[model samples]
Target: MAVQANFENIASYLQQFSHDRSIPPLEKWNPDYCGEMDLVIKANGEWWHEGRPIRRQKMVDLFAKILWKEQDDYFLKTPVEKIKIQVEDAPLLISAVDQVEIDGKQYLQMTTQNQDVFVIDAEHPIYMRAFDGEMRPYVKVRYELEALVQRNVFYHLVNYGELYDEPNCTCLKLHSGDAQFTLCM
Candidate 1:
């Protein structure tokens, strides 16, 4: 899935000072595209897809409650955004970009449905070189992602007012809850 996917333009748009045909591709500003994976979740319940009985609701709710609400990374509490499912059909992508926004912008988020999601074991060398400040491994990337997500979600939850309050979340805890004491609920 990583090799056969698309980049949703999260990076700042590329700039070409001038269309110099003599310019080498490597010399020109070009950013490698990052691949994404999607998940399609289903449960054992009566669902009316175009009008058909598919998986049950219990299964869907189970995923949402356990992985998502329970705050499981690679599940929901991860850095993923714009999660939607192609319900009532033989599994499809559900676009959730109509509402969610980040840094005054809206973008498509990567996700995996109907499959057990896994984080990449190491960070891309390019990310390390570009982002600079932090030396993040693949596992660390997920935490950093979740940290960004935590901030955005925190702000959104606050604006919605539906959520009165939220607990403090950090990137370190999301990576590997080894010997460190995370601010647990």
Candidate 2:
């Protein structure tokens, strides 16, 4: 009974931001722990629940809205409930990138699989990690969550990377305005 009521409240709150692109104020929510959910965000950024894939884009986007992270764990949070969810790699994937130049400064903006846009700047920096001798890149999304930069998107970013001369050696760096993010060591 309480779980049903909490789900109703969560649904109502989600409805309020159904058409809005801005993310809901999840940080302000103080929901009760609703235990673990079957929801799992796979390494490829597919959302699943009850061992089945969630196929509807709109529904997936709605779930992504309520996604929250706490000290390395992911949860679907609302004003009345906080349900833990499994994340194989990242909560989302960087599906596309849009680059622009303003006043001679370059800006790289990336869009997540859930349609959330983030600019690669100080607040949202890109980091690369080597896994099995392959380079994997990630960009900070929000709420301490990061989106894995897809392979094709990473190749595109490599085209924009410039060779920078550091004090010790030359390294490849991606630039956005005055901020320079080293792509490689």
TM, every model: 0.17, 0.86
Question: In candidate 2, what are the lDDT values of residues 25-66, reduced to their tens digit?
Answer: 888989889887767899888887778898988778888888
lDDT of 2: 0.83
Q: Give the TM-score of candidate 2.
A: 0.86
- lDDT per residue (tens digit) for residues 68-98 in model 1: 2112322222122322222221121211111
Estimate the lDDT of model 1: 0.25
Error of 2 at 115 (Å): 1.2
Off by over 4 Å in 1: 1-54, 67-95, 109-185
On lDDT, the candidate that comes out on top is: 2
List residue ranges in candidate 2 displaced over 4 A: 1-12, 130-134, 163-171
